[model samples]
Structures are given as structure tokens and as C-alpha cells.
Target: MTNTDVTQLDNPLWYALKGAQQAYAIGSSHIRRYRSGILPFAAYDYRSPGNIAELDSFLEKDEVFFLVGALPSLPSHWKLIRELPCAQMTLELPPAPLQTTTAVTALTAADRDTMFELIHRVQPGYYEPDTHQLGNYFGIWQDDKLVAIAGERMRLEGMVEISAVCTDPAYTGRGYAQQLIVHICRTNLEKGNMLFLHVLTSNERAIRLYEHLGFRQRRVISFWKLINAGTILGTKL
Candidate 1:
């Protein structure tokens, strides 16, 4: 078997988080234009003037919207949005002695419906605004029920993101999540792509798991979703 190289992976976990957005038509014409023109792969370019206006307009157009990327620190007038912790896990296979379970496999077209349902069940309110463009989502099933899953979402030329990871809450204590992560990183490394993901900084449990599984801590980024006239006058997070 070809050995995986974890050292060559991308350093910052936020890189994958940059592309979580998908096009939506509910925003103002200008907002839609700006969001469409925004580069999904470049996370830094969002600091430009009117970027906040664009996002705020986008949010006001709809009751709720999804914004993924580093959020800038703003004033107290804005609500404290949910925080997603970002992490980068390397592809280093642990000793085989530790894994003594049934084999895991890639997901198939037949698994899409059930897989998505299972994901929502585990991580409620998590939905891809653009499912048509969803990348390589994978899963492991047991006796026809999807148990654990981890796979790609936003992808650029040299990078692929690992996201939508969810295991049945009832099966939490098991190593199912670790197994799925191992499979994900191995596949990405083999394909010459690096793996990255975002999680809430407050989620100590997940942070511990990633660190134990060979993932390193990366820089923190503020994630935001502004609506109406929610522009930052002058600041950076």
C-alpha cells in the first residue's frame, strides 16, 4: 500500500471554510452581483468596501442565510452569531491494532437520500444552500443504516474540504467518527489534495478528537452573516 504523507497538507483550516457559500437569488440586485463576483476561494478579499453591504443585503432578502468564512469583529448591535471551529487533520493512519471493526466503504448514489437525512438528524439545521454542486460526500453504513460519514464540500484546484461529518448520536462513544476521518484524509492524500474543515472553538470535545487523530490547531477566524445595513465602519477581527 502507498503510504500517506500528512506533512504536505495545507496548514490553515480556514482555507476550506472560505468556499462554503452558494449562490442565492433572494438578495438585492447589487448584493447578488457582489456575492456572485466574490471569489469563493479567496477568503481575504472580503475586506473590500461594500462587502458588508452585500452580505447584509443578502441576509435581509431572506429571513435566514448562510455565510461561511472568517468574520470580522463588529459592534454589539449585531447578534453573536454561531461560531464554527476550524481544524486541519492530517492523513496519518494509526496502528491497525486499534481499529477492530467492520469495514467501511464509499457512499453510492443509492445512499444520497438516506445519507443527507442522517446528516441533518445528527447536525440539525445544517444544509447546503447548493446541493447540486456538493462535492464528494461519503459515508459508512451498517446493515443498511448509515452510521458515520465525512466527505468533501467546497473544492478548489489544489484543495478539497472535509465537511458534513456526523455520526449517530446513539453511537457517539464509538470510534466511528475517527474511522470516517481516516478514510477521508487517506482518500484526499491519495488524490494529491489536502484536507481542511471548520468547527466551533467552544467545542472542546471535537477539538480533542481532532488533535488525537493527528489534526493540528489552526488560527481562529470570526464567522459572520450580516443583514440590512450591517457594515463595519472601520475594523478587522
Candidate 2:
């Protein structure tokens, strides 16, 4: 599908709340969010009083969640904790070839514990224990240890997000990440799905690697992290 054909690309989180990943969503008519363990993202129809009120009702004291897409007018009970600027990137199928030296293996339930450990040690805070439910994951093992991984995350009818790409700190610079990304890209393209992903704007190293692999920066998205105004000084999420 062409860019114009996929309206969901314009407001990805909102559409995801209403699309394939909707099973994980919780909210009323105007607002919706993925369950806490699934993702920290939430989205509303747009900037409106009713939508803001509905969103506030779903948040707990001291709990934080991200509002992705265009900035919205928030309710008084919600506090703007932080604004993270991110780059929304998309790639056409079959990214340029990369040397596939390492053996990439499909991961399964048996690998969950080790996967979580590697993710927590390297790319923490975002990946959930059950994130594997989103789609297939592939890993590069070094001496029987999972040293790197890349996988699919969000999915709409015609597109799938390539996310949770990380490598153990000790395993970096080995070309594991690059190979796995290329594998996932080629697999998704063969399945006829467009690929997209998000990365922090400040991560220039990752940006360079993705661009070199044929992914292009689409837009700058704002991740507005909001906390309940009633939160106490030391409470945690």
C-alpha cells in the first residue's frame, strides 16, 4: 500500500488502539491505552475536553503513560512529565543486503526468560515480558546464549512494526543486530507487509545504521509522558 492509502500511518497509536492490537487496549469511547504491561502508549481521538477527561480517568496516581502523535490539550488533573522527541521511520520491503554471517534462529516460549534478561540488561523500560505476543522474534546466539534480537511489534492490516532491536552490551559490534534486522525486513516484505519503526531522535548511531539499511525518516513524533497531578513525591509506576 502507498503512503496515502494507509491512513493509520498518520496517527499510528490511535489506529493501533482501534486495530489489530486492540485486544490489549482499555478505555472508553474517546480515549484508549494499551494495558500497562503491554505498552506505555495511549491515544485519544484528538484534542477535546471529553477525550482528555476520558484519558485522565484511566490513569492512576503517579502512573505515567505516553501520548503519541500530535500534542493534545490535557486535562488539569494530568501533569506533563516529559516530552520525548522521536523519529518515525519506515522502510520499503527488501532492504539492501547486509552480510549474514551469524546464524539467526527463531525464538520461542522457551527463550522468554533469557530474552527478558537480555532486553532488561540492554534496552530496558520499553519491552514487556509478553511483548513476544506481538509477532515473531529472531535471535543470534553466541555459544548457546542469546546475544541479540529483533522482532515485530505493532501491526495493522497492511503494516507491521519492527521493534525491540537490541544486543547485549558485550555482543555489540559483531554485526548481529544488522543481520537480524535484514532478516526480519526481508521476511516481512515477502509476506507483503510494509515495515516501520520508531527511535529516539537523539540516537544518531541507530539512525545512521537504519538509514544505511534503506529505512527513511518519515516524521518527528512527540511522546508526551504524562503523570497524574495527584501523584505523591516518591510514588513510582
Candidate 3:
């Protein structure tokens, strides 16, 4: 499959919400968002003030979520909290020979709590409580514990996002994440899906690991964190 398709990547949330993942979407053609808790993300087809107002109404008074692309002009009711710039990377071809140590186990509802614990322990703020249901997840187990995990998110027509790739701090450098990534890419490739992912620009170690695993930086994108500040003392999400 050709991974050169950049049309959907520009506004992945919009395309995903309007396409394969529409079942979890809320809002209209002008603006769309994932249902709360599954993924705190929203997108707009057009950058109009009307669309912005429509988006604001979809949020709770003190709700926090992200616009996964270039930031747009906002009304005073909406507040810009933080901007997370990320290197959007892609891997077109199959990964090099990957010989993993631990067996890769398919994760399920029974393992949801453990998966949440491990992902949040290593990296927080991205993965949500019910995000696991969005796609298939696989993990590496050590002594019956899930030490590492990687899985799909934001499915387009021919593209899929590889997300939540993390390892238990103690299990770092054990090639567990690399193993899971290869498995995801290889499996998706067989299904005619090209793989992509995003990493924080400040995370050089992770960038290097992804590069080593055949992922090339496609572009830099920002996840704009915004809030419907009904009150000044709203809590962080």
C-alpha cells in the first residue's frame, strides 16, 4: 500500500471522525469530536467563527480537549492552555527483522486496567480510560505483568495511527516497545494499512528509537489544548 497519502493526515481527527471512527464522533459536518473520555480530541472542517462557537457548545463548562492540527483563532470563552508540538512520523514499508524476547500477547477487556496502569505510569495525559476500545492493543508481559504496549488509533481509509507505544520505566531499553511496534506495522501492512505516529518534539530518545525502527519524520504538528473556561478555577484534564 502507498503511504504517500497526505490528504487525511492534515486533519486526521476530522477525517477519522467523519470516516471509519464516526461511530464515536459527536457534532456536525462543520465540526466533530470524539465522545468525551474515549479521546479528548476535536476538529473542524472550516476555520469559521460559527464553527468555533459550535465546538464550544459541545464541551462541558470546564471541559478540556485538543484540536489536533494548526491552532485557530478562538473566542474569549475558550482558553488556550498549552500547545504540544509533535513530530508526525510514518513507516511505509515493513520493519527490519525483529526478534523479540517476550511473547506479544493480545490485550482485551480483561487486561484494560493493567494496560491503563502501565501506559499512565510511563507516559500520562495522552491515553484515556476507554481509548483501548478504539483499536487492537498488544503488550509484552514479564512475570505476568504488562510491561509494554503499542496499538492503533485514528483509522483512515488506508492509513492507521500507531499510538500509546510505551514501556514500564524498569523495562526501558529491553526492546519491548520496538517489538510491539514491529508487530503493529507488520500486521497492519498485511491488511493494506500504512502506519503513522506522533512523538513530542522534545522527546529525542523516543525519536531515535522510532527512527531506528524505520519510522521517518513526516512533519511537525501540534496538539492544541483548549478549554471552555466557564470558570477561572477549572481543573486540568
Candidate 4:
């Protein structure tokens, strides 16, 4: 469907949210932002329609918005702001590896702390306390230490998002991310769902790695974050 038709009840975001509890689970942080009085500058989904005047009222206070499903037409009163093209990638299964590694295994409860530390070491900004508590996490262990991890985030109908992918810094060149991605996607495929993920346009290396591992670019998306009024410059997200 075109972006203009997003106001319809069948908008992708609505169906996606309704169909995928995992998506809702992963995105709960975002939804909570609006619920907690952080005005979303980029609200989409059209499941609950509101006019620009309605948005403008909130816009002046804080403009932390999200654009989901398809882009919507702005009201005449609103002016253009910054726009950047992001990308979504999808990989079909059984995620055949370009290289091989041991079978992916479900992370045990004991593995959680080490898994968190490994991910945080590579990507400290990841794993808000909320995301950490969200779902079952999976990992690849070398000896007793967790080397890499990938797991469920969002779910919609027959699809699941593979997220929280990270590798230990010292282990970067070993293709752990690739192995974990294949293992995760294959695991999801066995359960009869497709895999999809989002990455920044500037992350060329990651995009290339995903492509090499059989993922293809599905579409370009715009990630518009509205600046929260009280947020200090250079503050972490």
C-alpha cells in the first residue's frame, strides 16, 4: 500500500503489531516513550488517526516521533525537517552458512549474564534494561564464555526480527556474527517464520556482511527521531 493510504485500518504497523507479539515486546520501549509523556514526532501506523493540528499541539512540547509501516503525508501546516534513508533487510532460510560453525543453541539462564556482558562489550549502548528483560536470548559459546548472540525481538504474523546481534571485540575477525545470524535465521525458519532486520544506511560493512550471508535489501526506511525537549546534546539514546 502507498504511504498516503496509511490512515486505513489495515496499515502494516497495525497488522504487524496485532499479528506479532514479539514486535510489540521489542517495541514496548518506544510505545512507553509516548505513554511516559515523551511526544513522538514521528508517529505512524494510522490505526489511531490524528490530524496535524493534533500533532502540532504535541510537537511544540517534544517531537520524538517514529515512522512505521509507510510514510504519511504531513499536514500543510507542518514543514519539512531532516530525512535520511534507512534500510531493511530480509534473509530466507534455512540460513545456509557461507562458512560453518557449530549448531546454534538456546542460551541457558546461566548464560544470560555473560551474554549481556559480551553484547555490551561490543555495543555498550545496546540493551536498555527494558530490552534485556524482553525475550529468550540465544548465544554461541566458546568454552565457557559467550562469543556471540542473536535472538528474537519483533514478531508479526509469520515473521520474526533477529536482533541484539553482537560479537566480542577480541573475536571480531572470526565471523561469529555471520555464524550467529545464520543459526538464528535457520532456527526461526524451522519454526516457519521469515527473518527481517533494520540497519543504518551508514553501516556499509554490516550491510555487506548481511548481503554476503544471503540477505537482500527489502526497502529503504526513514528513521526520524524527534528531539526530546529536555535531552542534552550528545546524550545517549
Model 3 collision count: 0
How are the candidates ranked when ordered by TM-score, highest leading? 3, 2, 1, 4
Top of the candidates by lDDT: 3
Which residues of candidate 4, in runs, are more than 4 Å off? 1-16, 22-43, 47-84, 92-94, 97-103, 108-113, 124-126, 130-135, 230-237
Write one digit per residue (lDDT tens) for candidate 1, span 115-172. Answer: 7678778875554333324566666677678788877765544556677778987677
Superior candidate under lDDT, 2 versus 3: 3
Q: Root-mean-square deviation of each candidate, in angstroms? A: 7.0, 3.4, 3.3, 7.4
| lDDT for position 92 in model 4 | 40
Q: Which model, 2 or 4, shows the larger TM-score?
A: 2
**Per-residue accuracy of model 4 over 19-128 as CA lDDT, tens digit each:** 43433322332221222221132344353444323444334434445545454555543444555566778774245546565656687656656766776677653344
lDDT for each residue of candidate 2 in 1-237, tens digit (9 for 90 to 100): 423346677678777777778898898767888887777778887644355566656677867777887776666667898888889899943577765667899999888888888987898767778778778999999977999999988787778888889998888998888898889988878777888889999999999999988899889887788877672323433
Question: What are the lDDT figures for the candidates, one per model?
Answer: 0.52, 0.80, 0.84, 0.56
Ordered from best to worst lDDT, the candidate numbers read 3, 2, 4, 1
Worst 10 residues of 3 by lDDT: 228-237
lDDT of 2: 0.80
Can you give the lDDT of residue 172 in candidate 2?
92
Q: Could you tell me the lDDT of residue 125 within candidate 4?
A: 39
- Give the TM-score comparing model 4 with the true structure, all chains together: 0.65
Off by over 4 Å in 3: 2-4, 47-50, 231-237
